[model samples]
Target: MTGHVRPYRSYVYAYPHKTAYRPLPEPGPALRDLWRDERKDALSLYLHIPFCEVRCGFCNLFTRIGAPDELTGRYLDALDRQATAVRDALGDTAPVRFANAAFGGGTPTFLEAAELERLCDIAEKRMGADLRAIPLSVEASPATATADRLAVLAERGTTRLSLGVQSFVDEEARAAVRPQRRADVDAALARIRDARIPVLNIDLIYGIDGQTPASWRTSLDAALAWQPEELYLYPLYVRPLTGLARRTAVTDRDWDEQRLSLYRQGRDHLLAHGYEQVSMRMFRRPGAPAQGPDDHACQTDGMIGLGCGARSYTSTLHYSFDYAVDMGHIRAIIDAYTGTEDFTRAVHGRYVDGDEARRRHLLQSLLQARGMPLADYRDRFGAEPYDDFPAELAAFAARGWLDDDAPDGLLRLSPEGLAHSDALGPELFSAEVRAAMAAYAVK
Candidate 1:
């Protein structure tokens, strides 16, 4: 056994983070070539709004504080221009069928009610995506989940609304540097219910400084009061430039153990409340509708990401605008994105070779509650995942993290393995990718 101890938060194996991405030498032609023969049956659409009311202490996402009075309009104008160019670039690939759609980042609802409506128009009218025909998910914050915004979303076929309520206790929220009141969270929940969206997902955090088990339960129980369709319990992570990182003084191992304990408590609590464990962090009530098949399953299909922070995925490359954790750098990128007229090409991305593709498929599937199917792997790659990643799989099995002897021939994670998913994910990363990510400039 290696006896390594990782932070136990989510791992970085090619989703969300853009640290490994490099500038494409031939952006336009490269994208065209990548998408030339790509499947058009089903695709996922993502639109990012990189503006937020406040920057939380633990946030390392690509978002800036609330836009100035006229900035939102200018951003939207840029988005429209990019959408038109992207649609045009698709050429014959223009009318690809989209199975899922989402508006995320910072806060999609941070826009005014009218702006929200226009945002939907851009998705439908400009991008040629039929939001009404597919499941649509949008992210919001307690402070911004306003009545008018929710109404526009509901009318525009937003099936799910996810709210970031890191904690229900006002004191704990303050401790985490996430400014909000319990009353505001409750009010937002009520408004969401009133909007009659099919699903309501609540996001909570554990392992914050000065947080106790009692405090965690208080937050969890308060969230359960609404019987939310989905609940996500995230472990607090203090990255290099985040507010929490500047103030945090805890040892990594100690924090990891505390987070592990909290994760177990939260998982067991949700299971007792008739919620199914979708993964280490996600819980779903018994009768809640699934959040669309294509939402998280991007390995099999293509994705078109529409704003500055969003990343578009082809079969072999994932591309996005420049990525940064510092506010100044993020602003610079957003400013550059707003002025750009050409959306026909990819500027920054990482290429996925055959080996990398296999690794992605394995990582994405194995990390979920559903194990990776041996037959499916063989069908896709003409060889079992075990054949390609024998050492990694064997090591996990030896560590009691995998069910190597499952009768179904599926590679599944044991409970202990699930608990150590963060560690496992990085171990699967290619050395080259890891070095590239490590060398990335944080600011």
Candidate 2:
């Protein structure tokens, strides 16, 4: 509705580069040393619920369809064990005041009410912190949301709930295999509103197979009708192993033009409805109450991810377990808390050459629609961005990708740069940085 729709070829053959990511052995004293040196307090926790009642066509997240209820209960027990292990590892070094806690997965609401409460209790007891004060967010599918279920979540300190409403059109919804009906989404929103939860974020997707500009606009209009506190717009990404990727007819979709149009239209509609653009994909209404950070906290402030398929980060190392729900990875991570292992080696073993500190700072700044502060960089790394990335900045400025007149100590993206940000971002990095990132593929 607001931006141009340009037809471009979808890179069907584009393949992610292979990386040397190997699962680390169980935690030992070496891992413990890494945690102590980081001195992390005010942590964020992500609980991965890997069970879903139904699987969406486009999803590649670590989840299984039609998981038995008994299996869900077993996973909850494992989660409790993992949480305790993580808490013992931190041991009095930094008072663990949680900044944020999120329940993400196949569908957090899919868990039985008692199971959800037990998981929260385990996290609170093991972490030995006031969990109620921290912002607890969860992702829920509309079909799984009931008035009683939402009430349970709100009463248990869930301040925010993100509803996955990919599209409002029945045909498009069916094509994407989203489980809930449009009416179900409305009922879920009404229930959440009745509970008086402060923030509700609706997740909308564009550029899916069979999606059109008109259909996208319709979805936006329907979402606006609900007046959610925040809206997240994402282009559908085709993962190689997913059901959507296996659909041969997907090759005919106009993914490029559809994405551009969705972005433009969604932004315009949200702005008209009094939502301010907080980041590239997020929009919030003006004068909204202060809330916790988005998804980048783990990347910014070093977080200890304590479940299967979760990734952990420290100042120097970044490690992730394989996708399987293996208890061995959890035990290994616990072991690392006691001994002295080369954390840098542990992180690099997964994706070598990742400078967690630098990457964290840079990514945080980027997420804020700003650039890294020169002063902060100097204080932390004893080097200036210009000094470290002189050639890259110069080249970026020459191409009008960066503003030469930006504040002396700030590295902010220009309006033009923001408009075409995806293309412009890589220009800020040196060839070596790009190569390193390509080689790593942390996502």
Candidate 3:
């Protein structure tokens, strides 16, 4: 930072934000060819359900509230078709294996018990992803994590179930426009435990209106009661087109300070409770059952995604269906997805060239508390990160964000670096990507 940098510039979950993606040229690369030369073994399978029971004010995820008039069934049908196409593309000519799988969305549990079974079947029969053999994870909400859904998921080998309990305090929940009582959240936790999933991840948010240090701790303790194997402490993002964006305009420094305070408090509290920091947003209990294949690395491994909201990542490209945040645009995209049939070629995506790839690898790896290994970077790119990004590394060090004491061959983030992850992560984005995002038609 030159002088004063805003801490919450943007969240860097994925490189080259979806906004950068444009329609692939006519006769875009076929899925078959896309995987023909790419590594198939140890791929990650992702199924996205774009329907949610309700949209939280702080949420900007590609999900719409409520699926009406058999919409859920239609969506699943499209997913099945897409899965079949993808499976055919990655033909058995070479090794094709799924090391891990995940069901995410508005809410995977938004479907009925039967629908949940069908969803699992699509992943298994259509895509050849052995859910039972791999680490399969699913996301749910308190209102939808019913016993029947729980039974179906457990039977199909869902190793980790992440429930979005943004806040356990009723007033704070209301402030964030995430409607749910603490009672319901508790019940959901009970159902999750009863299902015997190996890991339970509870997500909590900070910076909700009127949130205080005391209330934040209360939410943490409430979640801790379940002894969840993993905890994700998210700093609320009030992006445009979200419910909060319409109802609140909080872009002041005080809000940033408050969020930073809550974040530090939550981080220290989790550490005190024996949870290890995996990254700025992720904390895990020591020795918790690993969520996915031990060798699968997000930066290097390929991902096969199904459904409108899911984004597939090849080594050279990241692609997905039309992206939108406004409710009307989201609904229209879902409709188009359900109506489409030939799921053979990549449609909308941004190509990842070598420079972007290096940035992606470095940014994603560095955000983690464990940090990126210099040896890994050298092995992948045959060049050190410092060679590719000397100035960025220098700047991080000047700000006291880069850890000087990282073990032998690793590049790690200091506690302060981790705290300002949102700000620092975006600092690694290439200029072209920044321009694309700035000019993106967000709606």
- Quick one: best lDDT, which candidate? 3
lDDT of 3 by residue, 1-443 (tens): 46877788898878878888989998788988888888898898989999898899988899998988999999999998999999999988888889889999989999999999999999989988899999998999999999999999999999999999999999999999988999999988998899999999999999999999999999999999899999999998899989999999768998989899999999999999999998888999989998753312444549898999988999788899989999999999999999989999999999999999999889878888889999999998999999899998999999999888988899999999999999998899999999988888889
Q: State the weakest 10-residue window (summed lDDT) of model 3.
A: 292-301
Clashes of each: 0, 17, 0
lDDT of 3 at 143: 95
Candidate 2: tens digits of C-alpha lDDT, residues 1-443? 12342222221110111133354565423555656766557677777776678778887666666444376666666667667666766667566567778888778888877877877787778766455787888889887777777877888788888888888887888888665678777888788788777788898988776787788888998988878888887767666456676673544335555576677877777888889877566788676555777534545445666555456665555665444222233334323432322222233224324343454465456545555577887888787767766775675566555656778888876644444454444444434545654565333
Clashing pairs in 1: none
Q: Which runs in model 3 stand beyond 4 Å of their true positions?
A: 293-300
Candidate 2 minimal-lDDT segment of 10 residues: 9-18
The lDDT values for all models are 0.84, 0.64, 0.90
Query: RMSDs, each prediction?
Result: 1.8, 5.9, 1.5
Best by TM-score: 3
* lDDT against true structure, model 3: 0.90
